[model samples]
Target: MARKKIVFVIVEGPSDQDALELLLNKIFDRDRVFVHVTYGDITSRAGNTPANILKKVQAEVGKYAKNNHFEKSHFKEVIHIIDTDGTYVSEDRVIEDETVGKTIYSPDSITARDKQSIVERNLSKRKNVDKLQATPLIWGKIPYSVYYMSCNLDHVLYNKQNSSDEEKENDSFEFARKYKSDTDGFKRFISESDFSVGGDYQSSWEYIKEGKHSLERHTNLGLCFPDSER
Candidate 1:
């Protein structure tokens, strides 16, 4: 049997694509899942715009579909992931469980908050919500693969009080802090939560990783991976 080809387009940088590739290669099994990932201007402030991202995605998808001998019908089934850091205020907050979600900045790093607490603080609650369940957003013909974290590379993950190199390797928090502190670093995150087009890359990648093909109003989602029985 021939493997299915899925095209993934990210806004910019390699992180979004790297994360998806990790998940695909490790969790989804690469043998049956053929993937082509493209990195556009996901990291840049200008390229993160919804219109620009969508335009690039459409062009790439169209090109691949034609090259792969896929017609409009098959192209309709192709999934697109346009990652964002969720820098927008609207997308950053979602009222779930009577709590408003927001991003908070620490001395060394920034992390997302569900109401007053960090997302990690409510890991138990995260289990209740299906991790894979996607929400179709009003970005374009594509739904996003959203991972709106509070911290970018600029934010320190480990020690907010101290930003020494010794503290970084011990914990992820410190590492985040170092990245954020760097000059023109990718520490500041954006996504559907926030309005910055620059932060939309990760969510976009997540969209394609889950095999979501956005067409017109109605979306083609819940397409299960070959190994995972949905």
Candidate 2:
């Protein structure tokens, strides 16, 4: 019998994989779902550009394939899930404050100790995300797509704009338990909730990148499901 192909999902953290892995597995019941945790936002990583991001993703996929003795044909698609992080906001909107030790995300603005650095990171991230959205294939063999959770996965799921590590893990665990046996219910929440962006894939991307939408609660993940489910 032929093996089911892989739905390789790339995410930014273990919590992300944990929160959605079970539900994603249920959604793609006939195929395998493997979520790759990137640890940090790859789009904002140092030295990452539009062109090299492709190579970076390919490297991650290749590493997995080699480890599993899987060939390129084993993959059905590479779906990247990342935080929007208000990456498209204007430089003026990035505020600098000394009291805060780390970056803070809000629907209308981002605050950090270093405003210029935040602005620069946003600029770089915006470019890379735009590039990835335009690239339909990666490694010349895998169908690739990227989705956003603005200002991040935690926000979209837990409505927590910014959370401590302990808080994040707790929230993610609770969320997972909530829908562990209800994949269809999970699907509806993402597709029909107020936070769910109402549009096709490309249009959702377009909407998030506009104004402060990237920092708001919005997701286009419904498009990743099968057409029948959608």
Candidate 3:
């Protein structure tokens, strides 16, 4: 029998990997997809940034090719999913004068201009290296909060503020507990979501301000799915 084709997905952490694994499995045969966690943020000096992660991916592909005596073509796609973390601003920066509510500086607080600047800055810093250009890279702008009904997955899952990193790890499982049980419903939610005007961090912030879950709605995981599934 021919070996199954694999799709590689590099995520920020285990929670992200878990959440995507559930969705990917629904869209394709479980055996055909592989989701990996970078275990840290892109800004960190770890194997998580776009350039470093791609290196890891290439290494893995090489290993598989050597082990199985197969060609690198065995892999179909290499997708990178990362959170914008509110345009790389520190969450400690507090918004002091909001009368309606004590709003903090977050990705939701960033303007379109600032968001674009941040994206450009990050991209500029990316090392010039060859990547799997045919792959589809998805950005989860600001964070996964854009996906879970416009709320932070940590707060929604654990119902607490200032959650620990370990607590945050459970986000995917909690999301699956609610959303994955009804696969078709979840699929419809993803397919019909229209969260942003322009599908960028600034647009996501606008939708978030309107008390909408637009970010979660606009997240594009379609590349991981088959045409029929999408």
Candidate 4:
């Protein structure tokens, strides 16, 4: 029998790996893809950054080709999934209100300048990876993509859209947690959700870039699986 094509993916955490695993199962044959989670915290090590992930991917591809005595084309795709958390602004940034004699800051808040800086920094990182001939699927913030599927896992699984913003913010983790015990349930929820309604890869990429799917949902999962059955 012919060997199945391999598509490699690197993600930040186990939850991300699980979610992408489920998604890839839908897009390709179950045994065709491999998802690796770095569990690297971006604050210190640039966890799952495009360049870092691609380095590992290159090593893996090299090893695989050497073992199989085949060319790199034996692999179908090599992709990275990164989260845009503190990349937008330093988490240490804070403002002092002299009038009130207090410090005011929210983890979720980003100034216009900070936003621009973050975007530029991320783009530069991506360009560095592209120079290495690998592209990544970046998720703006942590839960934005999960939010695109529904307000939260409760909303996606139970049709309950009443989750608070805080709950919604952590929905990706919650969904990943649930996926561990109930993989089928999560798969079922995904099958019935409208997460892929924005046409094909390029269209969805444009939608996310234009901030239609939430300014935070700036991911390229669509591009990673351009021909995926949606």
Candidate 5:
């Protein structure tokens, strides 16, 4: 039998991977599914530039391939998922709150102890996301796409945007468990949810950029798994 090619999924954090890893594997049964957790938001991290974003992705994919001794050709496609994190919101929507230690993302505003940090982070993240969206290939070969979960995976999946770390893990674990044996149900949950964005890929990206919509419950993840059933 021929070895199964890979469908590499790039995600922002462990929680994101924890939530969707099993479901994705079930959905892409014919292909090996690998979820590469970025640990942090790569786009908003310091020293990451729009110019080198794809290279960063290349490095991640390369690490996986190298350890497995699998060539790049072993992959079928790359699907990158990122949290919008209110990145497209206006500056005024980033409100400074003395009591808020970590940034709190609401539907219309981002409340942070350090508002400027959020503002600057949003600007840089938006630029890098645009760069990613504009690029159709990773490392000049693999087919690639970037999808959004705004203001983040927590918000879109659980309707809880400001969850603590413990809550996040519990929520993700439960969500994964709920749909682990019901991948089709998971597909319907994502595609038919109120937060699901309509239209083609490009238009979905465009939709997330308007006003404070990026801070709301919205996702284009359905675009990744058309005809998902086996």
Candidate 6:
């Protein structure tokens, strides 16, 4: 049988690109799959979204194509991994606002409560800090997954195995892996937390911890970050 074609991913940062690349590698055996994932600095400190991100993607791909002498057809398909925070003040709400900061309880205070509770509370505050809008039609051709999550930069970069200072200093892939891992944690944290004003944090926490299906969902999605899948 013919080998499957490789996929190209254009991401917001070098790290973002790496994370997905890692996931693909982990899920698919190296011998069976091949992927070329690259990233460009699509962020402006201004914020990123589908509309604005595509511009960056085009420019980066153009540069890569020019330097490598490759055509768009060289790859099976292109996937633009972008963060969709939802809502917008401009084209595609793909970007984020840096000037604002939402004050949620510190992680230290929340750690004493429950992990799931902390996740929901922080995620709830994401809207206040940044406008996250999920947009389709990024590449104008290829299908992609534009992840829309609450702005949790610290978790995104800090809580994963790939996030060691040593890894970050040495390889860009390590940094990206950490960020991707955080995305998984964030998802799990929120899904388990009861966003309802009076919901019990403890109950939700137990459901996430003891419930087989719930834990599996989190791990499956969480493992989406991938370690060696590359």
- Taken over the whole model, the C-alpha lDDT of each candidate is 0.32, 0.89, 0.44, 0.43, 0.90, 0.35
How many clashes show up per model?
59, 0, 4, 0, 0, 15
lDDT of 6 at 184: 49
lDDT of 2 by residue, 1-230 (tens): 88999999999998898899998999999999999888998899999998798899888999999999999988999999989999988887889998998799988999999998998899899999999988889877789998889899999999998899888888889999999998889999988999998667788888998888988899998878875222
Cα misplacement distance, residue 15 of candidate 2 (Å): 0.6
Residues 125-210, candidate 5, lDDT per residue (tens digit)? 99999999988888668999999999899999999989998999999999998898898899988988889986788889899999
Candidate 6, 178: how far from true, in Å? 12
TM-score of each: 0.34, 0.97, 0.54, 0.47, 0.96, 0.40
Mind giving the per-residue lDDT tens digits that candidate 3 earns over 42-154?
43333445556445545544555577675555566555554433332332222234243322222234233244443453343232111222223322111111122222333
Deviation from native of the Cα of residue 200 in model 3, angstroms: 13
109 Cα displacement, candidate 4 (Å) = 3.7
**Superposed model 2: Cα runs more than 4 Å off:** 228-230
Candidate 1 residue-wise lDDT at 67: 84
Error of 1 at 45 (Å): 5.1
Model 6's alpha-carbon lDDT is 0.35
* Model 3 lDDT, full chain set: 0.44
The local lDDT score (0 to 100) that residue 150 gets in candidate 3 is: 23
Q: Which stretches of candidate 3 lie over 4 Å from their true place?
A: 43-71, 88-107, 110-163, 194-218, 228-230
Model 3 vs. true fold: TM = 0.54
By lDDT, is 1 or 3 better?
3
Off by over 4 Å in 1: 2-11, 30-40, 43-53, 66-86, 89-230
- Candidate 2 or 4, higher TM-score? 2
